[model samples]
Target: MERLLRIENVTQKFGGLTALNNVNMHVDKGEIVGIIGPNGSGKTTMFNIITGIYRPTEGQVLYQDEPITGMEPYLISRKGLARTFQNIRLFSRMTAFDNVVIGMHARTKTNMCDIVLHLPRKRREEKECEERAMELLKLVDLYDVRYELASSLSYGHQRRLEIARALATGAEILLLDEPAAGMNEQETDELLQIIRRIKELKKTVILIDHDMKFVMNICERLYVLNYGVLIADGTPEEISKNQDVIDAYLGEDDE
Candidate 1:
């Protein structure tokens, strides 16, 4: 299996607080991996570091074996790394389709001169982006609501639309933060299907979720974190039985 992303001895600190302490984890191509822990176990902190929002205080992040730590967030996105936030950060006034089209900006090729001159290149690019955006919307099962304002969609639809937008960035490795957080059972089931479809596209996914059933059902591998430390990493079965994970986060309700 080819490793697509690696976090080697990554330690992140905010003044006196250590949000992540010498954590090590990796994701291989075409895998759905779960990062699970209690509320502040550095799950989002890990996503931030990987997406270049915050540079780790120690160690490095490797993508396809190339160091990408401290790279600009836009540059990382251009390199095919994209993510969705725990809090939905959509443009409330914009249509769902437009939101997805905007995500393709980093990957689109059109200069100001071409756009200003109404050049064929610009027209062609715009058409292509629109087509791709529609396809992404369809992927998330939001094609019917493509013209709807993001703010008007249901919470589950909004979350799925965010996934489509992330996919529009041409990302091969997607970091999803708590995608199942605000979802009901039906919506969570829909998300599971969507993520499986993403893997079918050969994309790698790393997700954080408090829903054990969802995580165990969807993820092939699991990494358990607690208080900024990596306590365990293995298959779902292994993690379900990890004593430290149980003591720290899972408790008696892991099943």
Candidate 2:
């Protein structure tokens, strides 16, 4: 399998505190990988490093064999990497359709002159964006509510909308932070199906979530983190039995 993303011995520091220490991980093309760790274990910090929110103090991040460390977030996004925050980020006033269309900004080629003159090129691109936006909305099961304001959607729907917007960015790799954070059982089931559909689209996914069942069921492989360190990585079955991962999550028994 081809490696699509890699974190090579990454270390992140702020002032005197180390958020990530010598962490190494990788994701292959078309694979759904999960990063599971308790809170404050540097999971979000790792995502930030991958997305260029912070440059690693040591080592580097590579995408498709090219170093992407320290690159601007937008630049990295333009290179086909995009992410959703742990908190929902959306245009509260904008319709769902429009919110998704806005996410395609990086893919648009219309210049000021093209828009000012209303050229055929602009019209063609506008049509394409609208069509793609609808396609994505449907993929995430939001087609019926495409005209609703993002703020009016349910929490689970809002999370799915975020996924749609990320897909709108033409991202080959989608990083989702805590996607199942507040979802109920039914909503989480829906999310699982939605993610399977995304996988069918041949997109790679790297997600951080605290729901172990959801993570194990959806992810083909998992990476475990504890106290800024990578403790273990393997298939769900292996990880379930790994002592380090067991200790990290459930603590060692005194008995």
Taken over the whole model, the C-alpha lDDT of each candidate is: 0.92, 0.93
Worst 10 residues of 2 by lDDT: 246-255
TM-score to true structure, per model: 0.96, 0.97
Question: What's model 1's overall lDDT?
Answer: 0.92
User: Which candidate number maximizes TM-score?
Assistant: 2
Clashes of 2: 0
Cα lDDT tens digits, model 2, 38-113, are 8778999999999999988998999999999999999999999999999999998999999999999987878898
Task: Please provide the root mean square deviation of candidate 2 (C-alpha atoms, Å).
Answer: 2.3
Model 2 misplaced stretches (Cα beyond 4 Å)? 252-255
